[model samples]
Target chain A: MARINSAAQLEKVRKDIVLKKDPNKPCIAICGGIGCLGGREDLIRAFEKEIKKQKLEGKVDVRVTGCHGFCAQGPNIVIYPEEICYTKVKPEDAQQIISETVVGKTIVDRLVYIDPNTGEKAVHQSEIPFYKKQVRNILGMNPKIDPKSIDDYLAIGGYSSLAKALLEMKPQEVLEEVKKANLRGRGGGGFPAGLKWETARNAPAELKYVICNGHEGEPGAYMDRAIFQGNPHLIIEGLIIGGYAIGAKQGFIYTRHDMPRLRENIDIALEAAREHGFIGNDILGSGFDFDIEVHLDVGIFVSGEASALMRSIEGKAPEPRPKYTRTAVKGIWERPSNLNNVETWANVPQIIGKGADWYLGIGSEGSKGTKMISLSGNIVNSGVVEVPFGTSLKEIVYDIGGGIPNGKKLKAIHFGAAMGGSLPAELIDTPLDFDVMSKLGAAIGAGGLFVMDEDTSMVEMNRFFLEFLADESCGKCVPCREGIRQMLRILTRMSMGKGKEGDIEALEELCEVGSLASLCALGKTTSSPIYSSLRYFRNEYEASIEDKGCTV
Target chain B: MSDILLTIDGKEVRAKEGMTVLNAAQSSGIFIPTLCHHEKLEPYGGCRICTVEVESRGRTNYVASCLYPVEKNLVVRTRSEKIDKIRKVLIELLLAHAPDSPQLLEMAKEYGAKSVRFGKEPSFCVLCGLCVRYCAEVKKKNAIAFVDQGPKREINFIPEIASKECWNCKECFPLCPTSYLQAAYVLTQGLVGFKNS
Candidate 1:
């Protein structure tokens, strides 16, 4: 195992690790994301026992990876090389995963993920309509290995990416490659990765830092937490790589304290990285000293903002400052710092391992790489799914999400958490890329894709968003403070059909003012959901105002 | 830190980096109505009441100042006729939803919310991200969060089937505007105590 330092070395290591058939051995990867932890716990053990019973323990490897993203297909089991995905697997089906797929190299027709609309049994994850068009850059590692086993990741050439980066490419080159990939921050705001790194690199402070925003505050979103839990090391690796690239000696992962499991696993993974010399004051022995510390959240939604989050990390109350410097130039104790979300960091090793050209080849123009989405709410198969950028909302809900449960019709789709906008039933066919969603008045926020059914009330929906905004507005500014108070009142009135003749017009006006007067991203993006709702579902507001009641 | 001068509602004020437009107004003794906006939780930008008119780069744009970062040469309008009208409607809606609560009713009246046009119905937590954000940010114990999607979304106490993830710290209850938290606590406490008794 040679310590790799650069892309040239990575290219060589990749060739050396190109997967080929052992013929005598087979591999199985299971879904270890929290969504599957409970129901699939026993099944995983059963799978282990069945493998042993069949005397294939040494020859066949069974590992668990993080969220496969298609949570609806939980108790997910995928066979290697062939990429055959078995969905809704129960304890009874464990034998089939081991015997049929492991031994005979055959697909289990009944256990395969079935497309609800086409009624087709999806065997290979790629062939499945939900996955076929997906690029899966951020979530690429989920399907290939288990989160619990480093060796499973190793066998699939996981650390090889890091090894190559350390041994072959220079830090500057690695950053440039990432820039060429055109990777944007997938944690809601599409900030460029290279720009942050360059700013940090050139900043005037000596104690530079890199922070991982694992504080997934969006409603109905869990991509960051799932990735952190599923493949803690991958993120750690990315963090270390980011630290090295930006010349930072320290890094921090700001995760909510509520997710004890994620915190615990990340600690364990950090220890593992330290043991491997991947973290803690040195390289594979390259003398590039970089380390990471976990900072549990102190309970402020707005604190996820770079400056506010930095304030909390310093053991201060999480509060916002209006004229704060960029986190890249003056963050984390007023030093030059770079912040990327869990998903952003996860893509580093891959880009460094495989050339930037290879990474750039996937995804639509401007938005490259795969996005892991937690598809939940109202949908029949509420699960996690990782797809390439540009996949449509219809494909995610129908093809991967298995449509709404009980045969309910979809009313609208909400993207980018609570602050994001909702699309009407007519736009269900819309593609779910960054540009497309922004044009539709929605954004791919934090990777939480929640489906809504016909029973959902749009007025209530907008009001719900308002309620979140009002409480989380930090009260540092009048527009956000007073504006949210007023908006919440109006939305509540509208939802209850107490809206006056000018209520809708009033709301539209407030939407404008709130957008203009607010002081941070929280206020700036507040009207996003409201405007989105108004754009698609004006009738709901009209009903609340004109009809003096909710239609639903 | 260097300070930049900006005007909010014709009041020229100086602010530092990391301060929001809302903070500048409040410091200047200008009060704005708010609902879900809490100082402790992360900004959700879910509510639109905190909106204002911002003139920047020779153009005017509407933004929520709570979540928006203030910049140099930015002019902000905290209140306008358009903003007030919307605020009144929002109050009316809150009154209708939680008509039983005197607090909401008074706010509605202040905003000139006349009446709820429809019959009253049962209510829940106002869907403010307080509990959810608190669980994630303050307690660092995100046992409960906003679960489900769309208008029917709720503050789920442990998504994908309930578990003991909730320490029942009662942090979310105090922050809930609609008293849904109080109701849930009472019901849950009663059920548990009854079983034990």
Candidate 2:
């Protein structure tokens, strides 16, 4: 493989890869994402052995690709150009899949996704209701490309944005395009990404840095993991573009150490990007030098905070300092640095490749583009969903998520994690725009949407979040460390039917102090769950206090 | 360096550029309560006792005065009803942890924090991170660090370096408000004795 030297050479290579590939050929794309790979490593081996035994090795193109988003059905396989999707596929079923679907073009009835409401069996991937509603700009390529192979990415027009940005547009123009797109930080803050870039670009520092925050420590969130494992080149491309936009030559990807598959895939993708001349020195002959170093977090949740992340990168204990000076001005060894979450960085290419107006035409007024939601808990179809920003919660929970399992009534939807709050079942029609959700006291934080059913206890849920926050807090400031500890004690006692008179008032006081006085977002937003729960479900707390038992 | 003029508690103060609110307040003879702040060491905003309401550019924010840089035309209220209430609550919370510490007790009295509302655990260490910061910043030993997170967060000696470096170096012992460091050292040394036995 020759290194791509210029934008014209990259375009030539893309054309060659596209022209050489046969679209009409029988290709098997097995869902090798983390969700599908659970207890299904044998499926890949079975397909390999059967293909070899049947003398269909080269004739049938078998590739293991990333997630397909509809993870309720595991070990999913999609046969293309026909787009036939098979779900709940087993190792033994690979033989029939190869002989019947690949060779004979016969549809497998048992493996197709059956719609619960219509009693209809969907044959193709696009026909499924979960994928039907989603406008997957970034995740749409997950089913097409093998993550380890850069050729597949190039064939699918992966780094075309980098080429367009480097060859055609100047750095200021690229930054202006992103600014015009009105892209906010998807890492839960919703701060304008354009302004952040401008600050880092204009700061009086000879050396600047860009970081990708992939350490998604939220309990139910796995969208970052899916994007990193499934489509690593997209992230790498976005990071390189961000490095160029911010005038930084060095970048870092800070991810959690637990996801080994994501780590492996990212490692491969970075090395491939470097070898292909997208990462290291004089990228695409544009004279912009940028490279990324992958740093695994130290397993603390607060380490994902921007300042604390920089501190961890500097080889110190990950504690957040007061942000009198924004991290964009002075970060990472006192140099201007730009750090964005994985999803936020992934959205950059589309804004640059396609016009900013094109990207802004999708979502609501304030927020632009689509958001990747990690739908989990009691939902019928629990996985990742990429939806437009203004999509209502009812549409997501009922339509895309397949509603509650076992015909249970939707009790509450916990948006975000401990830092974000929950909304009652009555507010299901709330649109998922950042301002709209935050107006209702719940945030679209990092896209963690956890659904609860009728049998769930609101007090218990609040206590569970408090316990999580208590465990994940960095214990830096007094209000966070002591305030969270005191609130947890009161909530634990109330959950156990030992409620004092002023427990509610005490919890409110703690929330006030924690929100006002705590240093970092972790401590500042830790009281969100408690405050919103107490607002909506005061009866639950009252029941535990007065009746000495939970009503639910 | 340029001089930044600010008003703290309705008194005009002239501060140099990059000077913190606490330094500016102290330079102009204004008193502010603090627990984890040390002039000889870098500012650790863990205790949050010196939080003040500062209005700049028409936005009011409660910031830790020790770390927040003084800006020109910034209006700082060192003592207000809301500020006093938050400070009192913080002192009460600290009293629950270090009930016997003379420094914490004095602060509680000064802030008029009459009662310990939460159940007292009577711990000696307040989790102020002063010792941890001092060891890492001033001494450059990094022998001690905060482990775990949230409520279970506690200061512990790094096992790899603790045994080799911390026995004779008692530099952070005096910085701790309570005798928790001496007690922890004795207990760890007792564990070492048990290992030998």
Candidate 3:
């Protein structure tokens, strides 16, 4: 394979790859994401052996792709052209899936997703309620391509956005388009990405840096992992474009060390991208040079914080510095740096490929793009779901989520993992907007939504979140280290049926002090769970104190 | 470099452009209490003791004076009712961990923070990272550092370095607000001997 020297050469390669492939060809895309591969290696092997046994080489394509999002019903497989969706597939079912779905074009009744409320079996991918309501702009490619193959990405018009950005538009023009799109960082804070880039570009530094926050230390969130493992080139393309836009020659992807597959996929994608000239020196012959290095988190939650992440990258303990100056202005060895979330970076290519108005027309007034949420806990169909902003929480929990399992009533929904607060079931009408959620004392966070049923105790939930926050706090600040310790102590005693008169007031006072005096977001938002729990469920605390146990 | 004029507690003061609020206040004879902050070391901002309300560019926020750089026209309130309340809570929290530290106890007394609302454990180390920073920055030894995280976070001397290098130097011992580092030094020396034997 020759390196692409110019944008025309890259476009020619994409055209050549696309012309060789037939859209109507039969292709089996098996879900190879971490969630779906739970002892399902044999399932993939079965498909390979069965295809060879049937002598269907080149006639049928068996590709192992990333997570299909409906993780509760995985290992999942989708047959292209007809778009036959199969769920909860096993090794024995692989042969039948090939014969019945791929060759015969007959849909298997049991493998299709059956709507829990309607008892309707949805054969195609678009018919199911879970996939119907989602507007999967970024995640839509996961089922269509194999992560290990660069050609699969190119055939789908992958690096065309980078080529377009480098060849057609100036750096300032690209930044202006992103600003018009109103894309916010999906990694908790939702800061405007365009503003961050403009600051880094204008900062007085000869060498600037761009970092992708893939640490994703939030307990239940796997959206970053899915995107990183499934579509590594998308992130790579976005990073290269970002480096070009910010005048940065170097970039880094700081992900968690625990996920080995995600790291391997990203490495392969980077090598392939460099070989294709989408990365490395003289990208697309536009006189732009950029490269990316992948770094792993050091098993700490606060490392996801921007300042702390920069410190970690600098070989120091991952503790956040005081934000007297924004990190974009002075960061990463005192050079200008731009750090955006994995999802925020992934949205860049779409905003560039299609115009900003096309991207803006999809979402609500303020937030103008789809958000990929990792829905887990009490829901029936737990996986990742990408919905446009302004979609109600009730619709997410019911229409797309297939409602709570075991016919149990949902009591509350916990958003933003430990840092975010919980909203009672009655407030499910709240739009999934960043501002709206923050107004209700809850945060959309990094797209982790944990549903709780009737049997779940709010008091124990509060204790669980406090324990997580206390364990993850950097111990750098007083309000975080000492304050969280005292709050946990009081909550523990209260949970153990050891009631006291002044405990509630003490907890409230501690919340105010911790929120006000803490140094970083990790310490500041630690009180959110406690404050919201007390706000909505004060009766639970009162009952625990008066009755010496939980009331519900 | 040009100096910036700012108001600290309603008194006009002039400070260097890069000077922190704590440095400006101290140079101007206005007092703001702090722990885990040393003039020679980089500001850690871990202990929120010197937090003050600052109104800058139409927005008011409480920031640690040790790390917040001085700006022209900045309005800084070093002592106030709300500031005092937050400081008392911070002192009370610190008191629970380091009840025997004379410096902490004196600060608590000065701030009228009489009682430890969350109970006490009688610990001597307040996790101020003074000894850790001193070893890394001034001594340039890098012998002792923090390990673990959250409430379980603690400091320990690197066994190899402590045995090979730190035994000859006691520079960080007197820097601890409490006498905890002195005891740690004795214990570490004994452990080194045991390991060598």
Candidate 4:
């Protein structure tokens, strides 16, 4: 339990930890992510009990890991060395799994994912269509590492970026490398992370701060929980590296209050990092000292907005202020605070560990490297997907998501929640680039991609988003609060077949006020769904108005 | 403070650094409508009535004149086709709440805001936060603040404090853009007067 004094010592520790573990040993890693853990909390216990009953103690490891990302096939377990992935596993199957698969080393055909059309069984996790196409640089270790154990992270080269940033690279050099990579922020805006770092680093401040926006409150998005809960040290490592680059001595992780497990995992990871000297004073013999504190969000959608998130950190109400003064220059007690989403922070290690050129080689123009999108809503494979930028919507919808369920025709793809827009099925050929999607009017806000089937009413879908925005709006700004209410009322009446004349024009005017004048991004993009829906599905609005009754 | 030269409605104006566009415009006798702004309180950017088309760093965006700081070479158009349209809608939306506020009606007259376009759902409180901001920023009494959010958002006086402090000082009452604040304060008073006895 000695502190890692130097980079060499850290490397030696990693080697020693790697040497102690057997790579070929039988390990049963379960998907303990929130969505997959539907009464399967005792799956770990069941496996351990079955392993003991078979007297296979010490031979078999029953490790409860974070999300495997194939959540539609819930209660998933992967038996390792063979990388055998089993889905929809029951507690009763634990006995057979230990006796047959662990002892006999045979595949469990009944539990393995079968290609629905072909009926061909996919044995390994990598072989499955969902995992085959995904670039799992961030979440690839989810099935291997135990989140509670820092050694699990270290064994797989976790804190090496922090070590390299501290010992090898200068703070300015590290900042330059991130800038060179053009690592865009994954937290909604896709602002260049390095530019933000340079500002925070150069801003005159005796004290500054860096924050990880773990408040993934964007409706159906759960990628933050997937990777963060899977490997807490990944974000911790990235945050420390960011802290070193940004010249900040302190960091804060502002996450959701509703998810206790996500916060608990982050807490355990921080304590482990502190004990190992990866976070505390003079990390890895480098004179630079930085530490992070975890803070719970106010549990609202706007609380995830950068300004409001900082206000909550300052123990104030999570209402957003205008960003005329960027949070990077003035934030959190008026100190320069650089805040990036958890996914953005998670990508920092890869950029730093590998060269900027190597990181830059992964994705398309303007956007560099992979993006973790939380795929949900009428899709066959409802899970977390990490794909490189420029991956076509068709690829994601069909290859990764396994297409729409129940032979339903694809209606539209809604990216982001409430504050984002919807794309019709015809635009499935579009790339997942920052500029391309925003140009199409559908922003990749927090990477929540909801697939709507033919049965899905575009009007009802848009109404749902507006209702959510109306409910979640902080009501500080008149344009956002009153605008959303008025728009929602018109849409509500339209849905119930009471659409009056000029309702469309009234909604459009309110939308203009929302986008043009509202104080923050939440207000600025409040009309996104409305605008996008009205653009593509104006006929749906007219249909509802023309005595079609409630289309939903 | 040093002077920052900027163009307001095509007129060159010298404003002190750290001064807002609203302050700069008002000093130059330019008319920019605002509802939630107060000289004594902090810039709350809530009303969006003072929103102007500001061109900075080759990008033009709509920002509240009350909150956006004056920068060098900033082009401020207090009145533009888009800015006027946005203000008209913002006024119309606020009118849905406080349809009869003298302050809103005056701006509506200027902007030609049509309130009948939107359905009537009068909660009366425009959520300008003037009364709340006045109580907290000016009085430092923390007597009243906004409670709840979105459509349900309202200015509520803390019964414990308003019962004692408000009887002597009804300072925030005059700051309310609508009579809703007085109605809210009266309701809180009745509740508190009953509780105290």
Candidate 5:
């Protein structure tokens, strides 16, 4: 396909791309995500080989897509058109799927998802309880598009939003839609994206920048990787539209250094987009010149912070600068730079294509649009689930997460790991809004929900966070570095049967110093592990002091 | 730059636009304590001992005066009961690493910080980055710099450069808050075996 020079040409190309494709055609989408890759059965090659063995070339399309978000059952495959969801798919099962399901049009009863609680099998992916409550507006496109193919993305009206933004809507109008929609940052902080874009737009700078924060350094968080790797074009499209809106001639995707496949997919998507004129000079004949470059991070957790991320992009050390003036106004070489998470970037096209009111129609009152959460740690389901805002924590833990395994009761649910707080099972009723969760001492931080079972000790959990954070911290501020070290020593002694009388008071003093006097957010909120744990489960710490036993 | 008026410690002070609150406070007589801050270097906000309570737009926030740019009508309190308590804890946290440093001892006395509270881990270096920043910024000799990260972080002299540069010019020696900088330089010189070239 040649470069689409105008909006009419883009529509024509989309029509041609959609004209040749058949929706009824059988497409085998294998979960090739980081979670399920080289899984229990290497099913990608197996399905390909089985398709060839049956000599169904054009009749069947075996596409390796991104994660389907049902990773508890390894090597998931979704047979399309019919949307027949198969869980725990094995290499040998490929032959039967090709022979029975693809050819004979029969349902494979054994591979279907069975609700463990109800003991009932479901044929379609949507019927599973794990997916029933989810509002998968962003990740739902993963199963349909092969990351390497631009046509797959275009078939779903992918760049049509960019077209609408470029052809018809003014930059101000696009900004207005986003501001009215109130789309919050998905990579934590939950600040409105439109406000940042508006700041970058209005700032008195001839040279401005927009960055996609794909350096998902949050532990157990892979939703950014899922949406970005599975569908890079969608995110690139979002970046292009953002650049057009923010009047930034240059854009960047600041992604992680690890995950070579994710990087490879992004490269392919960028090349395909540049070839198709969605990027590069005079995009789609709108005379709006903008291009994007991909930058790799230093692979530290704090490099994901906005200021630290900007400094890292400047080829400097990944130490966070004070953000008294927000990064939107002065960032990335001291220019107005608008940076949003990859997940937040992915939400832009939807808002631009379907108006702000349409986008705001979903989710809660405060937060608009959907959030993708990566479930991990003792949870039964333990996969990526995208649900709208205001979904209660109890619903997410039980319905979507499948609760804790081994018949053990839940002790607490932790969010944002070292920087985020933990809430006991009693407060799991709190909804997944930014203000609501943070008001309860828990945050919807980058949407990583880690569940702890009844046998787990909160005292030991605090020690674990401190131990990990004591090293991962940037070591710039006196309060954070020395404070975490002192707290870790106290928690270790308390866990190792050597608790002192004033250890709790010392920890509290350290927490006060950390919260009040640290330089960055990482320094300030580093005491969250102690804050929420002591708030909800102080008895565990008191018991550890009294019993003088290793809680672990 | 135009003069911007803001109240520091309940007194109206006129500060230049784009000037940090630390400099503005220093222009007046209001004292804000800082350890890693230096006039010749960029404000690092690392030690955070210069934290002051700034109330503006109905929000009270503790910000490092060394880096926070002075805003119009910013109500800055250089010292308060809460600020004293916070400074006491901060000094105590730093004193655990270098209890014998006279500079830290002076501040500890002022803030009522007890060195024995955290029980002395004793690395001696407070990681002020004074020698590092001074060497890099003022002397134009990148001899000593910060290495590693987190609690393992420390300032070390570049033996290759320090051996060539430091014997004639020991400008950073007086800037050390503790004896750790001298000790680290001696150790690095021993490792390099007295480069004469």
Candidate 6:
């Protein structure tokens, strides 16, 4: 494997790789994401040994790629360009992957992702509804492009957007275009992208910076981490464009240290970008010199907050500053900074390639793009889903997510991780966008969709989210520090079947104080799950309050 | 920065651009009950405990004050018996899961809570944003966020691995008034309405 040192050399190598497709040989790609890594690495090794045992080394290319996103059906394997998806593969089946599929070029009926509704085994990845609804602007190229391999990314028109940006578009135009597209920050806050960029781009400063909020501290939220694992280059390209638009030369990707594979993949992507002159000083012969450095998040939930994240990057305690001073104006050692989540940055290339109006045509009027939600919790096909914004909850839960697994009735669903609200089965028709979710007392915070079955107790659910918020709160203010303490107690007594009049009123008053006086979003919305759960399922709370026992 | 003025609970409050109705209310000494919220962390909007009746831009309904940004003509009601009742019931259920915390007991007393009206036993640790927010925002370590989602949401170290990264700093423990912080809040106010065992 010769190194493509320059852009010209990289272009030539990519062209050669694109033209040279080995029809005679079969290419096997196994999902190497975190979920699949559970004994799947051993399976990969076994597959390699089996391939070598058959003496089909050169003829067969066995590669371990990133997540295929149907996590509940992992360790997933797909063969291309045929794209035959094999689900729940074991080490013992390594021979079948090599013998039946590799040699016979046939599909393994038993291992395929069977559509639960149709009872039909999906031969190709596209046939599955999980992939059917997803546009895959970012993930579409991931299956073919090896995250660690620079040539693979280049082969699939990887840095072409960066090239186009550097050559054709100015920084301000890029910002305006993204803003025109109404691209909202995917990191919980539904702030307009253009406004954030404009604030930072025009901030009073000689030096400005851009940060990619890869610190996905939300529970069950792994969409950004998966993106970093699958298509690191796309995120890089987005960051590069963001840096150019914000007039920032230096950028940082604040990631959680828990994801070692993601960290490594990103490092490789950065190296690849730098080596090809797509990321470093004077990128692609353009005078604009933008480079990105990876900063490991201390791996705490609250650090996902922009202020805390910025503080961590500065090697200080990750405490959040008052929002009265926006981080965009003074952040990351007091420089005008623009920060966006991994998904937000990843959408830049698409917005640039296709005009904002063209991008807006994909989803609802307000949310004019696709959102990749990491759907988990009691679902049959728990995985990452990228659906148009306007897709209803029913469609997301049943159509794309394959509904609750093991024949359990859907009881509740939680959007936006722990901080986001939970909805009852009645609200299943709610649209799967930011605005619609808010109407139902929820928000699309960092794109995590979790399903709950009948077995789950709403009282227990309320306790669980509060427990999380209590642990995550920074305790900087009295209301959050004290209010959550008091609320937790009342909830504890209620769940224990201990009946006391006015307990509900007490909890409500405390919640009011916390919401009224707390300084940050953490304190404000921490009570969302309990409210939604109580509102929709008051009977559940009543059952526990009256009965004094776990119903399920 | 230019300041915007608004009235919360009839008290004049000054906030900058992008401030939420809740922030203005809190600054004006208005009390709005919330559980999943934390001052030092991000707004999750999951708990819905911070709901308040807000009249702004020609709409009046219970809004999650934490998520609703402030506006010039916004009117917020932070305290109401209806909200108080809902919060008390919600907290009673929360207490059933973590009844030992003195802090919670004391808080329950503030709301005139005597005992939980539902559930059977205390599970320890209420769903507050202290540990998760502190671990992430203050500690810069997402080693422990809410690991599972929905009814399964709980704090767990990332990868569920037993490593020094977790350190059991108990930095998160102190925030859990039921398990670590003061537990009197639960004993007093929260337990007022609870059915005696």
- Which residue pairs in candidate 4 have backbone atoms (N, alpha carbon, C) closer than 3 angstroms, thus clashing? none
lDDT of each: 0.73, 0.87, 0.87, 0.87, 0.88, 0.75
RMSD of each: 9.4, 2.1, 1.8, 1.6, 1.9, 9.6
Compared with the true structure, model 6 gives a TM-score of: 0.76
* DockQ comparisons of all candidates to the true complex: 0.08, 0.83, 0.83, 0.85, 0.83, 0.05
> CA lDDT of A302 in candidate 5?
82
lDDT of 5 by residue, B1-197 (tens): 77899999889999998899999999998888888888888888888889899998999999999999999999999899888988899888888888888988999999898988996875777888888889899989988888877777877777778777877877777777876455565546644764543
Runs in model 4 lying further than 4 Å from the true structure: A546-552, B180-197
A-chain TM-score, model 4: 0.98
lDDT of 6 by residue, A383-495 (tens): 88788888898988988888888888999888886678888898888887787787787788888988999898777777777788777887554456456666676677667
Instruction: Write candidate 3's Cα lDDT for A333-451 as tens digits.
Output: 99998999899999999999998999999877887799999999899989999999999999999999989999899999989988888899999998889888888988899999999
1 against 3, candidate with superior TM-score = 3
Residues A407-495, candidate 4: write the lDDT tens digits.
Answer: 99999999988888899999999999999999899989889999999898877777788888877999888888888888888888887
True-vs-predicted CA distance for residue B171, candidate 3, Å:
3.8
Q: Cα deviation in Å at residue A246, candidate 1?
A: 2.3
Task: Kindly report the docking quality category of candidate 3.
Answer: high
Clashes within 3 Å, all models in order: 108, 1, 0, 0, 0, 157
TM values, all candidates: 0.72, 0.96, 0.97, 0.97, 0.97, 0.76
Q: How high a TM-score does candidate 3 get?
A: 0.97
Compute the lDDT of residue A498 as modeled in candidate 6: 65
Regions of candidate 1 where Cα sits further than 4 Å from its true position: A1-23, A49-60, A79-84, A95-110, A113-122, A160-170, A402-409, A428-430, A468-478, A546-549, B1-197
Q: How high is the DockQ of candidate 6?
A: 0.05
